[model samples]
Target: MQVKDKVVIVTGAGSGIGRATALHFAHFGAKVVVSDIDLEKAQKVADEIVTNFGESLPIKANVAQYEEVENLIQHTVTAFGRLDVMVNNAGIGPKQLLKTAEHTLEDWEAVIAVNQTGVFYGMKLALQQMLKQGSGNIVNVASLAGLKASINNLSYSASKFAVVGMTKSAALEYAKTGIRINAVCPGYTESALLDKLLSARPDMDTMLKSIIPMKRYGDAKEIADAIVWLASDQTKFMTGQTLILDGGTSL
Candidate 1:
């Protein structure tokens, strides 16, 4: 709960919120494991942590694949001796936003694989390790879209909704097992994902910012701070809940 010396694994640590979370954990003195589909990016983040005098290990694993996730966990334990916190933060969105009826099966499947099923795999595999240790914590990254509807992001919205459900249900099931599960729903953050979406629909930029009362996008470090708090003793009694950081957009 203190996070100091705790062993934490952050998926998708190659960039964006995932990268920030990994760096944040290491800054708090946790032994961090940086896992990402891209080894180069993962290693770079890990190296940054080490350079800052914090501890970290970089491991490449695609959360969509069961074997890769399993290997990620095994490698973490082999290096750190135990898994204390698991951040299921890896996710992906559709290439292009389209009408529900216009979306292809490939689009749906690809998003579900990485966004929905990927969380399932991370939770399932992480829970196994946590149960073995008799106690641990999980911080899932959902989205504002998960709680409400995103105009043209059908598959992404659906996958995120599933993540919210999974986090709550699993938290309830494991409440008494010393393993706490919670989720963070961030909205319109300044990240590569947002850049990609904006690149596809540049016109939506103004509309997106106008909806949020803050009139600005969130910083990745702010979300990372919230995640680290959720995984700490400050929120020890909290589980099966979502901490929304959407700059009042959800309001």
Candidate 2:
């Protein structure tokens, strides 16, 4: 948990929160494994980590696919000798799934596959490795929507809610196994996904600001900082907790 020379794996590291977190871990002296569905993007991040801090590996893994995720963990352990931290940050929110009743089955399935099932897979595989070693840390990324219902994000909310539940349940199950599991619920943040949504809706900026007491969107680095703390020795006494970084939006 010192992070110095620790082995950390971050999924969805192509861009946004995942990318920021992968770099953050590297900056803190962790040997990071950067994974993304896009190999080029993952490799780019891993390359940057090495270029800056000198230890990283890039692997292509679609969290939604069990084989890819399994391979990702196996490769990391095989290469790093032990997995110290697991950040299950891969997720998706289909823009068109904003309509509660009008969204397609495909959209719901897709969101659940990546957002819900993906987190589950990451936790399970990471727990397996941690059990073998008798210790580890895991952080699953949920959302403010996961903590509370949103107006027009049905599929996304449902999947994220599942993540919140999964995090709590798994954390309790492994509470005595030396493996700690926790969740981070990030509110509306400056992410590529949000940028796309804002581009589509002209009035989104004002609408979003009005809802958040902070009157601003969160930066990706802010969320990454929270994740690093959660995965570090600083939180050794904590587990099954959900850290809400929503800028008081939930209030």
The best candidate by lDDT is: 1
- Give per-model TM-scores: 0.98, 0.97
lDDT string, candidate 1, 134-157, tens digits:
999999999999999886789999
Instruction: Give one digit per residue, the lDDT tens place, for model 2 in 91-139.
Output: 8887573577787788888988999889889988999999999999999
Question: Model 2 TM-score?
Answer: 0.97
What overall lDDT goes with each candidate model? 0.93, 0.91
Give the Å shift of residue 198 in candidate 1.
1.1
- Model 2 clashing residue pairs (backbone): none
- At residue 43, candidate 2 shows an lDDT of 90
Q: After superposition, how far is residue 80 of candidate 2 from its true place, in Å?
A: 0.6
RMSD of each: 0.9, 1.1
Model 1, position 138: C-alpha lDDT score: 96
Candidate 2 regions with alpha-carbon error over 4 angstroms: none
Which candidate should be chosen as best, given TM-score against the real structure?
A: 1
- Once fitted onto the true fold, the runs of candidate 1 whose alpha carbons sit more than 4 angstroms away are none
Candidate 2 CA-lDDT value: 0.91
